[model samples]
Target chain A: MKKKKMIISSQTMELDVVRKVEALSGTSVRRCFQCGKCSAGCPMATFMEHPPNRIVRLLQLGQWQRILAGRSIWYCASCETCSTRCPNKVHLASIMDALRKLSWDAEGPSKESYVQLANRLFLENIRSYGRQYEMRLAAVFNVKSGQFLKDLMLGPKLISKGKLKMFHQKNRNMAEIEKIFSRIEEMRKKGEAL
Target chain B: MDKTLNYAYYPGCSLHASAGEYDLSTRELFNLLGVGLTEVPDWFCCGATPAHNVDELLSLSLCAKNLELAEQVDGDVAVACAACFSRLKFTQHTLLEDETKRRQVEKAIDAPARLDGKVKHLLEILARDIGLERLASAVSKPLSGVKVACYYGCLLTRPPDVPNLDCVEAPTIMERVVEAAGAETVPWSHRMECCGANFTLSRPGVVIQLSNAILDSAKSSGADCVVVACPLCHGNLDMRQKEIEGVYNAEYGLPVFYITQLLAVACGAGAEKSGLGALMVDPFPLLKVKNIL
Candidate 1:
C-alpha cells in the first residue's frame, strides 16, 4: 500500500460535490477542526484507513475520492458515537451515510464489496417481502459473496434453537410497500427528492 | 401505575425470525405486567440501518409509513428493536425539523408523515410508563444472586436529543429496569459500546473482535450474564459467543439475555413462556444456581 501524495488545486478539488455531501447530510464539514474526538470514540476506527475526523477533513478539502476509494466510510459501524461525542456537532455518522450514498449511486470504486453487498440484499429483502427474512438474507449474502460455508456451522444450532425460520411470512400490505418504493424512485427520477 | 397503558407494538423484522424469543418475552412480560400491546397491523420494516445508510428518503418514508399504520390502534407506538426505535425517532425528528424532507416523505408514502405519535423503546415503557416500583412488586422470583451486565449497545441512547429515552452518555434505564426485577447490575465499561451491529452478516471478523471485547469486559466485571435490549447485540454476543471465544482463544460463556426475556422470567413466566431455550448459550445453569427457575 503506497501512500499517494495529496495534491490540492482547483482541478483536483470538487467543492460542488462536497456541497452536495453537506446538503445530503445536513451538516457542515468545515465545523470539524481536526478535533479527533470522533475518531477516538469510533469503535470501527481501527478497521478504517482514514478515521472519522480524517474523512471530514478530506471532505473539507474536496478529497472525497480518496475517502470513497478507501474502506473508511464502509467500515463505519454507524454506532453514532462520533455524532454523540462531537464537540463541534459535525454529525460524522450522517456524513458517513452521505458519502456511502454518493459512492453507492456512482457504483463505487470502493474495495469493500461485502458490506455493500449485504446492504443491497437487506434493502432488496425489504422491497420484495416488505420485511427482512434473516435466513434468506444470510443465505443469499453467503451465496453472492462466494463465502458459501460462512456461518454454516451456526445454521443447525440456530435452527435447533428456533432462531432462524425456514420460511418468512410476507407482509399482507406488500402492495403498499411496493408503492412506497416506486414512489421514492419516481421522486428521485423527477428530482423531487434527494 | 393503576392506569392501564396501551401501545401499538412494532416488533421490527428481527423479532419475527432470529429474535423470536424477544418477541415472545415482550408479549408474555407485557401481559403479566398488565400493559396492553397490540401488534401494529401489517407493519413493514422500518428500514433499520441499511436504508438510512444509503437512502435517507427511503428510510424516512418507510418509518413514516409505519407511523401512519401505528395510528390505527394505539396510545403511543411501542418499539422493541433499538435500531427500529432509533429510525422511527429520527424520522419524526427530521420530518419535524425539515419541512422539505417531511413533504417529500409524505409524497413517497402517499400519506401525511405522522410525527405526532410517540415512539418509545421497551425500556422507556417499562421504566417510565409502567413505573419501576410496580415492576419490582410484580417480580415473583427475585434474581437475588444473579449478576448482570446490562449492555445498551448503540441506538438506544446516542447522538443526543434523538431517542430521548435517557441520558445519552450514561444511561441507567437498563440497569434500573433489571435492578427493579431484583437482578444486580455490574458497573462494566463496555455497556454503551457498539457490538459490530449488522456486520455479523457482512464482516463477521469485525463482529468477532468487537463482540469479544464486549464479552471480555463483562466477564472480567464478574457478571454471570449480559443483558441486552437490541436483538443484533444479543446475536453478536450470544449467537457468536463461542466463535468469538475460539477466535480470541479465551473463555467467556456468558449468556446474553434480552431484557424482556429476563423480565418475563422474573415476573413468574416459565422457561417455555420466556423462550429461554432459544438462547444459544445455556442460561439454565446460572438460573438454577441462582434458584431463579
Candidate 2:
C-alpha cells in the first residue's frame, strides 16, 4: 500500500462537508478518539480500503473526497456491529449510510459501481412493483452488471424449489406508494430534506 | 391464556417471493399455537438495507407508511423477515428520538408518523409474548437428540438499542425458542456475524466467504443443522451451501431450517404445512435420521 502524504491546511480542509455528514448521520466524528473498536468488530473491514475507524478519521480530517472515491462505504453490509460495539456511541453504520447517500446523490465518483447498481435496481423494484420481484431483480442485475452467466446454476435449482416466483403481483396501493416517492422527491427539491 | 394474542403480520417482500416457505410456516405455526395473525392490508416494502443504504428518508417514509397501514389491523405488528423487522423498529426508534427526521418522514408519507405501534419479530412473539413454557407445551413432537445451531445472523439483535430483541452480543432468544421445541442448542461462534447480506446479489463472493465461516462454525460445533429467523440468512446459508462447500473444498451438508419451520414441525404441522420441502439442501435426511420426520 502506497502511503500518500496528507497536507492538512485551512484551504484543503472541507469542514463544511464534514458537518453535512455529522448532521446527516447524527453522530459526531470528533467524539471518536481512535478507540479502534469499530474497526476491530467490523465484518466488512477486510473488504474496505478505509476501515470504519479510518473512515471516521478521514471525516474528522475533512478528506471526504478520499473516503467517497474509495469502495469502503459501498462494501458495508449495514450489520450495525460497529454501532452496537462503539464505546463512544458513534453510529458508524448510520455514518456509512450517510456517506453512501451523499455519494449516491452526487452520482458517486465511487470506484464500486456494482453495489450502486444493485441499490438502484432494488429501489426501482420497490417503485415499479411496490415490492421486490426476486426473479426479475436477479435477471436484470446480471444483465446490467454484464455478469450474464453469474449464478446461472443456482437459478434452475431455485425455480425448481419454487423459491423464485415466475410472476409478481404489484401491491394494491401502488398509487399511494408512488405518491410517497414523489413527495420525498419534492421535499428534496424544496430543501426540506437531505 | 393471555387474552388470545393476535398480530398484524408483515411478511415483507422476500416472504411473498423467495422466502415463501417462511410465510407458510409462520401462518401454520401461529395457527397451531392458537394465535391469530392477520396480514396488514396493502402494505408495501419497508425499504430494507438498500433503501436505507442510499436514501434514509425514503427508508423511513416507507416504514412509516407501513406502520400506518399496520395500524388498520387489530394488534401490534408481527414481522417475519429480520431486515424488515430491523427497518420497522429503527423507524419507530428514530421517529421518537429525532424530531426533524420524524417531520420529514411524516410529510413524505403524507401522514403523521405512527411511532406508538409495537413492532415485534416472530422470535419475540414466541419467546416473550407466548412464553417459553407455553411454547414447550405446544410442542407435541420434541426434537430429541438433534443438536441445532441457532444462527442469529445480524438483524434480530444489534446496535445495542435498536431492535431490542435480546442482548446484542449474547442473545439467547433463538436458543430458548428452539429448546422449547426440544432441540439441543449448540454453543458456537459466528452466530451474530453478518452473512454479507444483500451482497448476496451484488457480490456473492463476499456472501460465499462470510456464510462459509458461519456454516463451518455450525458444523464444527456438532450442530446437525442450522436454524435461522431471517430469510436472507436462510438464502445465504442454505441456498448457497453447496456452492460454498464446493469453493472451500469442504463437505458440510448442513440443512438450514427456518425457526418457524422447526417449531411448526415440532408442534405437529406436516411437512407441507411447515414448507420443509422448499429447502434447497434437503432436511429430511437429518430429520428422519433423528426420527423427527
List residue ranges in candidate 1 displaced over 4 A: A1-13, B1-3
Candidate 1 residue-wise lDDT at B229: 94
Full-model lDDT, candidate 2: 0.92
- Give the alpha carbon lDDT tens digit for every residue of A91-154 in model 1: 8888999999999998978999999999999999999999999899989999999999999999
Instruction: Report the error of model 1 at residue A11, Å.
Output: 7.0
Instruction: Write model 1 residue lDDT over B123-241, tens digit each, in one string.
Output: 99899988999899999998898999999999999879899999999999899999999989999999999999999999999999999999999999999999999989999999999
lDDT digits (tens) for residues B111-148 of candidate 2: 89889889999999998998999899999899998999
* Number of the top-ranking candidate, with DockQ as the measure: 2
Compose the digit string of candidate 2's lDDT tens values, residues A1-194. 78999788655667778778878888877788999998998889999999999999888887888999999999999999999888889998999999999999999899999999999999999999999999889999999999999999999989999999989868998999999999999998999888
- Which DockQ value does candidate 1 get? 0.88
Worst 10 residues of 2 chain B by lDDT: B1-10
Model 2 achieves a DockQ score of 0.89
